[model samples]
Target: MPAQPDYTRRYTVEEYFALEEASDIRHEYYHGEIFPLDGPDGPEAKAGGTKRHNRLVQNCVVALRLALRGKGCDIFSENVRLAINEADHYNYPDVVVTCSPADRQDPRIVRYPSVIVEVLSASTEAHDRGWKFQQYQALPSLQHYVLVSQRRRLIEWYSRSDSGTWILASVRELDEAVTLSALDISLPVADLYENVETGPEEGPVLLRLPD
Candidate 1:
């Protein structure tokens, strides 16, 4: 195994931006710290998406595009940076939908996002559900946060209510659809898992006893 990479160093937002400009690796910045958004550290380490993860993300973006066409909304996938708060936090969501004119004009990080989607993996599921979602709650423009499962046909949906309460919803059945009242559109659950491969079985583990 390769030695673990170091990330204890802190950085200013300017420095983070400069690093991003100079390096090919993508990092998420939060409170003067950066976190890599790639696979595990080693020669075999690849980019951050499995076959299922990438397909689901692509399906989501395509669905949103059809629903929001000619509505002045833009959908970004994988590469665009989103500002959870201006300088304190930033992340690259799997899919981001923005209808704000200000966000459409911004060349760098998007300040206003209407919806954020994250395709869950073994490595990122906890962070996506915990601290990442917590930080995303602070964004005033965020109306919905969607989490799609990679190994199963399930989606965890969070939407803000009229009284500023966050409501939890789930779409687990193929016949069911996720009703996004914020976007005024319903995304069919089947569309997301269409013709995609998933559910890799775990292999048996063998224990080495006191060798």
Candidate 2:
């Protein structure tokens, strides 16, 4: 008989961080439920094409850093923590930009971010567009949420309007340029997917994160 795998029981936000191996995998705590973070599996999972996906994310990071020079806004990749609330939920997006001074000193976690970006993979597409989007919208300082696709060169920009509504804007194809009004910067889609290879029919698509 095969031995059964032992799953770690549910843990509170405080208990989740008390362990030494907490960094190994991302965990989400929702209403006292601790769930392992997982992306899509099967075909959607394979669509990522690791090298291409990673390159896309890296290119954006470099461009963003250069654009924000001397602006007092710090940008971070997935390793940085974003505390969603006091109870439990904490997340790490592909990129987070914070202009708030308080977040500058605390290198470990950021409470206020002006903009957040996620490079979409098949496995995480739904969550990113749905549940995760809801969580991010709750942050008072989150002015913009951007979703970049791995399959094709597409960008979706969600900006908060004066009416407290998030408006959707999209840029498709490598030739199109995208402007992030929140950051006061613009870039061509080609720069985002630089050095990435894709099939003729396989191009990135950007969609609104669900409300």
Candidate 3:
């Protein structure tokens, strides 16, 4: 196997945004290192599941779009890249809802996102719930962060209250419902996993291994 690329070089937030061609794949920059995202398999694959996870995300997006109809907010899927900070860390989330006008400048990437949703996968669950969560909190306009479980029909919502505290609200089973106050909408968990086939009821499983 070939040697992995070195990405320890530090970069300023400005320099990171100056890159002209930074698409085709996803990358995460930390401290000063840039790590290219791996292919969708293994941990990512498990999170994505066979077809259940895909439908869940899709259904959620559709519901959100309908809820925000006539509102200025635009809903985006995984293709849009989001610049988090310096070192040029850019990631593509499963769903992004942005009401900021700056989103029009670059249809392919968004700078300000009001809400970001990551479909929890075995490979990315930890970061989504931890480091990535920290980074997202830095955005002043961010009001909601959602994590959807792939193995089962569940949704965890983190909402930023008026006091700036992030409170956790959850929808445990498929029959339970969830509402995103940030977008002013509610959804049934069943819609999220319309065609999913879950195995035995497993206990709480952490999605990602520690870095």
Candidate 4:
């Protein structure tokens, strides 16, 4: 969701957690700032997932669920919070995968996701590519950060190398497949855009990542 700078009020991590529990809308907490992810303060409500966006997110769940079976890893989508570190960041990703036993025991959030997937929208595109990505990379367990275009047939896959360098790869064509070496599964671009329109108006051509 698009963040608003007008929100000047800051809350301690303790207060942020309490606010999240009491609030109806989901908000992303960064440091002491709270970025409301839904309602009037946010770019759009949590229920505002577009037809194509929601479809793509569900497709990711289907693909990940099948691929992760019997692997002892669990996949969570929407409404699940991912803590970047203990005291610094907490936000909800569209999809998150966690295999940590500690994460398995925690009911409030997952801290060690192996992968995070985001279905991009016009409002939240910049944050997803810029700040959000930077924070996700800080997680030691994160191996892949996947961005799926809701407006077009494109996927930007960012994988971390053994030396901690991030490698960027893009799959632009419908027939191309995005290989997640970490997960050992390749997702066909066509499969992600299946049943969804891909024309200029309906497609996500504007947010194509650089190769």
- TM-score winner between candidates 2 and 3: 2
Query: In candidate 2, which residue pairs clash?
Result: 40-123, 151-203, 151-204, 152-203, 152-204, 153-204
Regions more than 4 Å wrong, model 3 = 1-24, 40-50, 200-211
Instruction: State each model's CA lDDT, in order.
Output: 0.78, 0.73, 0.71, 0.79
Tens digits of per-residue lDDT for model 1, 59-140: 9999899888888889999888998867677778999999999986778677889999998775556667877788889889
Give TM per candidate: 0.87, 0.82, 0.79, 0.86
**lDDT at 129, model 2:** 79
* Model 1 collision count: 0
Q: What are the candidates' C-alpha RMSDs?
A: 6.1, 5.0, 4.0, 5.2
lDDT of 4 by residue, 1-211 (tens): 3333335787888987878777777878776877767675464433244676778888888878877788888899879889987796788898998878889778889989999999887667776898789888889999999998766678998999999999999999877988889878788887777787744533222322212
- TM-score ranking from best to worst? 1, 4, 2, 3
Candidate with the larger lDDT of 3 and 4: 4
Model 3 Cα lDDT, one tens digit per residue, 112-162: 999898887665676788888988898888999999887656689999999
* lDDT digits (tens) for residues 1-211 of candidate 2: 3222123465566766643144445545555555444333222344546676668779889878878898889999877778888676777788998999999777578899998998877656767877888899999999989998876667898999988899999998888876878778886788877887653445433432222
Query: Which portions of model 1 show Cα errors greater than 4 Å?
Result: 1-6, 42-49, 200-211
